[model samples]
Target: MLAGLLSAGVPFPKAIELADPKDLPDKFRDFIVLAFELGAPLVPTLSQLEVQMRHEERTSQEIDQAQAVPQATRTLLIWLPVVSFVLAQIMGLGTFSGILHPVGALAALLAGALLFAGYKISGRMLNSFLAPKPDPTLSLMVLRICLSAGEPLEKIRKRLEGYPDGGASQLVEISKRTGARLSFLIDSELEQLNQKLLSSRIEEARKLSVRLLIPLSLTTLPAFLLLTLPPIIIGFTQ
Candidate 1:
């Protein structure tokens, strides 16, 4: 039924509407419910998806910056303690022969402590580096696209009604308060909104969101592969 509605050029939300819940598959019912909750209006959703694509592109670029610093710092932290321990053992060989060098051991301990401190500092900086920036560009783009796609401000507001999850919801409220169309709001007042909500860190925030995709992708792939693959690869070979 959904396929039929889609074939007829109906929007996903509308298609779901046409297909009664009782007639639809359980999996499809879940999809429709999610779509409704996400405030789908076909064209608006397409526009939001486009914005997400752009965000992904920007995020890839930022990932390069994060990888160069944080990743290297984490590597250093992991290897430093092991290297220090090995070096101490190597130098202590003379101590077993009654030739202990207190100065050398102290130097090794100091070096290890310095390395550990550097690792901790770098880890903190990296955490800050990946934190999200409050960029209204995505929200603005979504609003513009929804308006351009022939959705009235009122209808858009209605769709976003009572949604308080920030971003989309906040914009919807702004539109209601200002009594301005989305295009005008974005073109004329988005900068002011940025100033008010993001202060001076807007660009940094945007960069961080972009950078996060790299680590997120790196982490997600392994987990996804683990979940998808069978538990046993080779069953007790003879």
Candidate 2:
């Protein structure tokens, strides 16, 4: 939509003004507006940004798909014992009757607490997984835009939200030694940054499979046994 508007010679800020806020992300709109203010080449910069955003979106979707089965299993692990206890009581199996004893009541409370803990911990794990990964290329991206716009490093460091002083200095040093354009060097770094982010995401997914197992064994399994065993023991004794 932005590319079409720009191609048709709509004024950059005017094009942005015309867009619905819901249709455009605030950060993206701000980036476009700032890039225009800095006199960066809007078309190519936006094209590159679009490609990166699409790739990140696809990666996120893939991670969510990978998580589906584990999430379902977690739900089942959480609910299966509770459902069994309910059914056992309904079927006149004396499940709640067994829990009417002082000892049984205490056991039920402990099991309930464990089950709740497992549920809360599992949710926290999922929240951490969904949290945004730190972008290694943010400073480089800002530098690229600044260099393209002929903005000074001091100006960028002061004005740009995430432009890092260290990264800017390193890029300048490399440019001086290699006689390379800072823009060109930053582009190469951006490519490598994408590859690094991909690898990091894969590692995170792998670790999540392991992290999820912690609650299953430590809390959920114990709760399941605490709930399940009493009924079985009672039936055998009867």
Candidate 3:
């Protein structure tokens, strides 16, 4: 509807001013208000946002590909006990009967708990690393474009409030207090900022890959022994 209004030659600010605020996202409203206030072209700014989102998507895909092997390895490790149990039964080792002794059952119970905790912690850590953070530079670009176009401070604040944790809101607030141009923070350093953010994320993913190994090993190694050793020990004793 907003697009249709813009296509009808209605001013960007006026189009938003006439529409219900409840219908629009706070950040989106900032774009329209900024364009209307400055008579700036919203298309190019929106296009930039699209490009940045695409870059983020590509980065996430790369991380997933890089992490796939470790994830598959964990899955197999989790199923190792079941495979061992089935194999032992086929061999008539009857190791499970031995494992049912009071002391043996207690040991098995303890091992199962440890395995559960390890996998849960590793999965949580992996997800935390995989989760995308809001693009810090994306917000800065929005704040700069709006402020440079002389968008209203109240309007900017209202829109930026949607993502309070982002750099855009904080930068705009700082600029307002300092009476500095928002563009001053981004105009020259924008590319550098983008590069820095990308590199930092890649580095973080790399470190997380290493951290994941510790938990996976802790879980899988003990599980390997618990499942494979008991039956062998029983067969030999008999």
Candidate 4:
């Protein structure tokens, strides 16, 4: 059905309207909706659309995989304390006896909680990393600089294609997707993007984040050694 729509040069939104929701894959539905809403231009080169679709699908699958694993792990972690307590009781070990004594059991419960919390925090961080944050003014400035240096839009896009973290490249990609004129899009969208980035408060947050990383990494090594060295030394002595 999508192929037929492409052949007929039907707009994506209209094609989606014509398609049966039950017949369409859930993953493709959002892309279809976005295309329709944005009125994304059709690339003459069908191969480009194919590649983009595949990349998006792969990314979606990877995110699903990550979410699935963590959910399953969390469920198992939640059961640990309950299971440990039960087993101790069943084995006739006093509540404060066995490897999982009161203190050890408390530590286990805390570790499990920390693990689940860490996973949730990391997932949010990963989503933030993946979502595009194109700054329109900065993008326009970059484009103008490139153009002044004798580069065309297409050439500039190609040059920045490999700049994975570039805000300008993200704006260009949005233009490519929407079939909008890059310059016009940049001018119209710059203010909105700037507002969003500012409201997110990421700049101040990033400064603090960067300052923490070095100290965090530095502290980790000594802490890890302190925790592990005694066990290693005891094993060797035995």
Candidate 5:
């Protein structure tokens, strides 16, 4: 609707005012209006948003690839206790009581602790995609857009109060500088910022798979042993 209105030659601010950002953060309502008043073009902001969506898609694919095996392993570990119980009953071992005997009870208690630990680990693994943090790159890109248009850094900071999480560190000295040379400088800074953001995400994904292994070995493996090993030994001895 905003695009259609803009195409129909409705003034940019009026077009934005007429269009509602449903389900979006209300802070954006003021942020976008401020951008228009600063003479920033809608095209650049939309282009940056496009870049972000693409990046998120790529990141999500990476997360799924990284999480698949760990998730399967976790599911198997979590359910082995139920399977162990059924197997014991089928083999003529006294069902829950055989597993609930004093020593067996100790084992079950330990297994419960490990199950809880494994649950926490799995939650963290899954949450990498589910609970997304604020993207620092987004605010940086907006800074680039507004600064390239010659807006002052102080004004940008004031407008960004409730927007993306970012700091004034990068733009502090930048505000004092100006001229034809500044365009090249901004381009270099934007490139560096993009690289930093991409690299951090890549590192995080790489670490996730390695980190999940600890919980699997420490908690899930022990959990499986607690649920299955005792019954097997008792079944053989009896």
Candidate 6:
């Protein structure tokens, strides 16, 4: 809508006002408007930004989809033993009588504790995946877009808050030393940022595959044994 409106010759601020607030962050919208006001080209810049945002959204959704099966499996792992015990009782396996015995009661308590610990630990691990953290590269991206405004370096730096002093500063320095265009250098940095972001996502997914095993081995397996074996042993003795 932003690009379409820009192509239709609507003013930048007005176009932003018309666009959905949910589609863009307030900081980004303000920076884009500032860039345009500072003489940056509108349609091309916004079009590229729109595409990047869409890709990020899609990537986030893909990560969530990737997590779905694992999440469901985790729930099942945490509940399967309890469900089995109930089923054994329902089937007249004498599990209730077993559970009434001292050893069976002890096993049940231990199983409950293991299940609780596994649930909490696994839940925390999974939540870490979805935790919201400020993207470090976001500051650089904002700085890059704002740089298009063609303002004096110091003046632009002052206006933009949270501008990273590392990559953005180096790109600006390199542009000055080599007499290269600052905007072009920033675009290259943005490309590198994209690659880094992709790599991080891949690494996170890899870690998730391994991290999931911690709960299975540490708690769920023991809980399963306790919940299943005692009932079977007691039923046999009875």
Candidate 1 similarity to native, TM-score: 0.41
lDDT of 3 by residue, 1-238 (tens): 5455656788968865775555654555555566667765665554444445455556667667766755766577666766876788679777677576655566567668767877798789878776857655555666656665667878766765655244666556677799877666554445556666667766776676677778867876786677657755665575
Per-model tally of clashing residue pairs: 2, 0, 0, 0, 0, 0
**Candidate 2 local lDDT, 25-46, one digit each (tens):** 5556666667788899877777
Better of 2 and 4 by TM-score: 2
lDDT of 5: 0.63
Candidate that would win on TM-score? 6
lDDT per residue (tens digit) for residues 1-238 in model 1: 4555665788867865776556643433443444455455544444443344444445556655545654654564446444544443365423222212344344444544554554555456567765765444544544555565566666666654433323665555776788866455565554454345433444554554455445444433333322222111111110
Candidate 6 TM-score versus the reference: 0.82
What tens digits encode model 6's per-residue C-alpha lDDT throughout 1-238?
7888989998867876898645676756765766567777777667767766775676677677777766876788888888988888888787778888899999999999998988888888888877874565565666666666555778756754564443777777788899998777766776677667666775786677578778866888888788878977898798
Give the Å shift of residue 186 in candidate 1.
Answer: 3.9
Rank the models by TM-score, top first.
6, 2, 5, 3, 1, 4
The residue pairs in collision within model 1 are 59-210, 133-205
Report model 3's TM-score to 2 decimal places. Answer: 0.63
Candidate with better lDDT, 1 vs 2: 2
Error of 6 at 81 (Å): 1.7
Candidate RMSDs in order: 14.8, 3.1, 6.4, 12.9, 4.8, 3.0
Write candidate 5's Cα lDDT for 15-102 as tens digits. 6578755533443444455557667666555444445445555666766665575567667766776677678778777545546566
What's the lDDT for residue 162 in model 6?
60
- Regions of candidate 3 where Cα sits further than 4 Å from its true position: 1-39, 88-92, 131-134, 152-190, 235-238
Q: Give me the runs in candidate 6 sitting further than 4 Å from their true place.
A: 10-18, 33-41, 90-92, 159-161, 164-166
Sort order, lDDT high to low:
6, 2, 3, 5, 1, 4
- lDDT of each candidate versus the true structure: 0.48, 0.72, 0.64, 0.47, 0.63, 0.74
